[model samples]
Target: MTSLTLVVFSLLAGLLLWQFYRLTVACRRANRVDWGRGWMNLLDGLNRLFCYRYHRLNVLGMRLPKQGPAIVVANHVSGLDPMLLLASARRPLRFIIAREEYQRYGLNWLFRAIGCIPVDREKKPEQALREALRCLRNGEVVALFPHGKIHLDSDPPRRIKAGAIRLSQITGAPIVPHHISGVRGEGGVISGVLLRSHARIKSTSPIYPEEWGREQLQALVQAVLDNKSEDLESIAN
Candidate 1:
């Protein structure tokens, strides 16, 4: 090989190595970001910019308690639901995502940067739940989709999970019921990039899980979602 060719290859290798090191450092810093620090504040600003500009997302009645930890339970419409909710929320949300998604090859760094907690659905989901509960107890906002999967159309108001409610009951954290509409896409990252889908998310006042039984809580969440969906539909029509 010519001496100049070797020099060019060495420069390219150095650049790649530098980029990898930066990614590694970012992942570690994301994991250790202090809860009450400004790091999350910066991220929240960036999130809002992305959602508002790219998806034309709108938020409504999104007031969470100013004092303590709260859990946001929303119906999943598409993969973009989390980003929509995160951007709309007043504070940074620590999302409880599936372990499989967290370990994705190229996007793992992004997930870690957002401080997402991964749940292993195949083996032990309880461990993930416990970690989420711990974060709640420490007064950090946690967000999750109780529908478990994307609920297209009206299939969501009926299908719900009790995990968010259970966590609220244990931690005495209020459950903020959020109903989202207009986030339908072909699904996945590439789909979001190619298809432009706007989002409309609405939130109800916090519901205290400790005050209600499991069934009652579930019914309340269902009612809130049904009502919110109706309002959004009427507006859209």
Candidate 2:
């Protein structure tokens, strides 16, 4: 081969190897708190890299405690939101997803591999909630998109589901409010990449559920959502 061609091939090979090394380090860091789900960190690393490249994901307030169970509640926009959160989190996160989405053809294995708990929205969502609570009690993080499903019609102000708050009330797990924006698309990977938007994750201080009623929990959520709405609006304009 020509000298120029040989040089180009060597450069490409070295770059690929460097990326693989970085991915390995990232996986190890994320797996520190993973509850026997380190394998999923490989996928999360890849997804996070994709978001960093295409979506410009900026995560804030992610300094979670080293130990203990906590509930992560976020506004769901696209399917990618979960992956984005997983990518940004320091611990392995168990997502409570809709059963239909969980059982999507050819993707069920992927969901199961990540230890996602599926909820039958039509019938027994309570079962899923119970499972999530159990996970929290066992000192694992449970992530819930309290909107119940992806809401792409508009920005914030959408009603927050009470399941997350209810879980916290039962388990005394701190609820971490996560508000995201700029996760554009119809929950499709290709569309999200093509959109090339700047996504942001705004996480607030953990709200302990100790001695707090459902009404109080709901009020805190509303206040957080209102603030997110204003932040999103300012970004748009």
Candidate 3:
């Protein structure tokens, strides 16, 4: 590995290993799962160590509702997006992850400790929907990359999957669109997806965050894409 990767790798492994052991012990006193805020606190420190800038964007003048199980729809740019969001997440979040990353070495164990839901891509998507909704029902932030896969050609007007819409409809949870723009890097090859750039997370349009019905949710996503004007497509092209 390169020097930077080595440094980051060693740091992460050391922190994760240390934190994992400590949390395992601490969690023994708790119930089945350890959903304590302690993990969040540790993650926040990790963010600082990694120089993660946690900025809340209010482009559309959006304010997150003080509640639970909200759908955090974010643009997929890098593997680091989850870490950044989780570390900077104001409240505890339960992530919806693809089978591969969810099953990756170290990540799976870590995700479990931090409360992430692993999904089988080959399985029926309805199952993923259920898991996401269930997390929501439990009053946890459910994160999803509406763009599905990473933006190989994430030009403006990003093309997002319909899953976020589907979940919002089912749970009546407001779909919070959090846009992540890549700054530097040759896609995922160089380093961080969010290597360096301005990041914006906005949840405008609703206060109590009413869930959009099936038809409405689809239209809402379409409108977002429409307004974005396929910006990623153009840039990537």
Candidate 4:
């Protein structure tokens, strides 16, 4: 009886190890950004699972350049917005987040590790802009919610901040606009992730800063985010 029990235990352990190995491979394959750490890679995989499985995120017409710097601007609805963008992206993104959100308890370390640039809106906002410029100069992608905060469609109309357009003009990086919709928790941070919803990310063509005036660019970005642009397309699942 003892011998039989030992054999069963060994078999179970082997099976568990095999499954773990498979999971590791899958994570590695799905991870586009080389986080350079095993734990981060695992986290990235888990994020992908959360967005694709739990939230059922559908990415449509999203195209990023294979290399060089670019600015990704998305509409802010829920905290899940960033995760949805990250999961759909094929490159690492340095997010320009609010200072308070960047300093969130227990998440500050992760935010720093992911290269988030924190802006103190009331004080020294240019500090974050400088950092964003540095990242772009280094050929890194910088992402931001031009809306500045979590603004819902049902709320009063608000103009998007001009920082993203300014960044594009200065860095000469094309701005890629994406609109997020169908989030279950529209305003809550944790609730946005915890709740299940059929989320969709619709991306439009890249807007070149050199081709349009600042005002025009801002209006174009707003149209894309509002889903009022006629160029939006969806990819087949």
Off by over 4 Å in 1: 1-43, 59-61, 156-158, 184-189, 226-237
Report residue 72 deviation for candidate 1 (angstroms): 0.5
> What digit string (tens of lDDT, one per residue) describes model 2 on residues 6-75?
9999999999999989878875653423445556656666676667766788855364556799888876
Model 3 segments more than 4 A misplaced: 1-40, 48-62, 152-158, 193-213, 222-237
Tens digit of per-residue lDDT, candidate 3, span 1-237 = 799999999999999999988755544432222246666455545553343443322223223467766777666665656655654455666777777877888657787777777778787657777777788888767777777666633455555678777677666777766555533442472365445544444333431225334655555554453345464234324
- Residue-level lDDT of model 4, residues 122-228, one tens digit each, is 99999999999999999989999998889887878888999999999998999999989999999988888889989999886777889887877888888787766
All candidates' lDDT scores? 0.74, 0.74, 0.58, 0.86
Best by TM-score: 4
Enumerate residue pairs that collide in model 3: 154-232, 155-231, 155-232, 155-233, 156-230, 156-231, 156-232, 156-233, 157-230, 157-231
What is the alpha-carbon lDDT of model 2 when measured against the actual structure? 0.74
Q: Which candidate is the best by lDDT?
A: 4
Q: Tens digits of per-residue lDDT for model 1 on 45-159?
A: 5556567777788745366787689988887766777777766666667899989889999989878877799999999999898889889888889988887876655552455
Give Cα distance to truth, residue 183, candidate 1, Å.
2.3
